[model samples]
Target: MPSEIAPAGLRERKKEETRRLLLEGAAHLFKERGFEGTTVADIAAYANVSVRTFFRYFESKEALLLPDGVEIFAYVEHALSERPADEAPLDAVCNALLAAAKPFSASTLTALSHPLEDIENVITARLVQAFSDFEERLTVLVQRRLPPDTPDADLKAAVIACAALSAVRAVLRTRRARRASGISDTGPAPLLRAFGILHEIGSPERP
Candidate 1:
């Protein structure tokens, strides 16, 4: 049975590899020629796969061009659980997101191309919809971390969760704008700057 299952596993791996290839190819094409200039056939040809094979991987070219961010969310869930109990609620949310972003940070910055357009209305909409459920789950966890005496704990949790999401979007948007303008690299400066902003956002006003 193990021997029989090995072939199936190998086939699945091959499919994933092809899918990744298509995604990479699509990203390059979208950056090079813009979204409207690129097509399903262009991505298929670039990835050395047939149009039918491309359909097997992604229903549309736009889907291939945009990242799903599933891995980042998975990392966030794990990071949140492992964060020190004494960590502040805002810090935990912010740090968990940045920590989760670490592995993909380089690729994410490198691929920061043309994120401003509404050419694909469903692009941001789709990603936002997917994140809503995870945000709710994180909000519950964050609320539990706060003291019981904290007033309006639900509102506090929702605020922190929303702020964290906004901070992430802001950082990526900055990088996209930088990339779109032919910036060579974003470096760790954006990360540091973003950290300071996120770290300070919900804090009490300084004297």
Candidate 2:
């Protein structure tokens, strides 16, 4: 049993390593050459793998930026579920977005942003569809946390989820702009600030 399992485990590890290499290679090339300038062959050569191997891991060059959604959705769900029961729905969602972002490094986030900025064709359409799915899922999750008798419960959930997601989008756009300006930003400070502005928008005016 151990012998059989060992080979299987080793194969899985190799597959994961190859996947990582492809992702890293794609990122590096995308950064250096821009998304439209970088081809699958380029990425494959960067990773020292055949182009066929690249196709085995990803459908196209665009896919390197657009990862599978299942894992991220699960992470967001778990983070949302773990938020304090007493927290406001929007606050919980914002915190969960922050938590969901914790796993990505600055370079990874920047790489993801490249496709977002450069390719306004297939990738853009796919991103819009993906965000719509996320928005719908977040609304359902937020609604689950609300009081059963809450007024306009569905409307409220959709608003809260959309607002939280907008905050994240705002942060990513800022990061992308800053990167283009040769400035660097890291950590969640910008994201927190975006949420702070969101909260302020909902508050009464102060002197």
User: Tell me, what's the RMSD of every candidate?
Assistant: 4.7, 3.9
Query: How many clashing residue pairs appear in each of the predictions shown?
Result: 0, 0
Model 1 Cα displacement at 27 (Å)?
A: 4.6
Candidate 1 residue-wise lDDT, 45-95, digit = tens = 987889998888787765654464556677887898888999988888877
Model 2 misplaced stretches (Cα beyond 4 Å)? 1-16, 24-56, 59-62, 68-70
- Computed on alpha carbons, the lDDT of every model, listed in order, comes to 0.73, 0.81
- Count backbone overlaps in model 2: 0
lDDT of 1: 0.73
Question: Lowest summed-lDDT stretch of 10 residues in model 1?
Answer: 109-118
Score residue 1 of candidate 2 by CA lDDT. 89
Best by TM-score: 2
Each prediction's TM-score versus the true structure: 0.69, 0.76
Count of clashes in candidate 1: 0
Compose the digit string of candidate 2's lDDT tens values, residues 127-171: 777778988999999999999999999999999999988787788
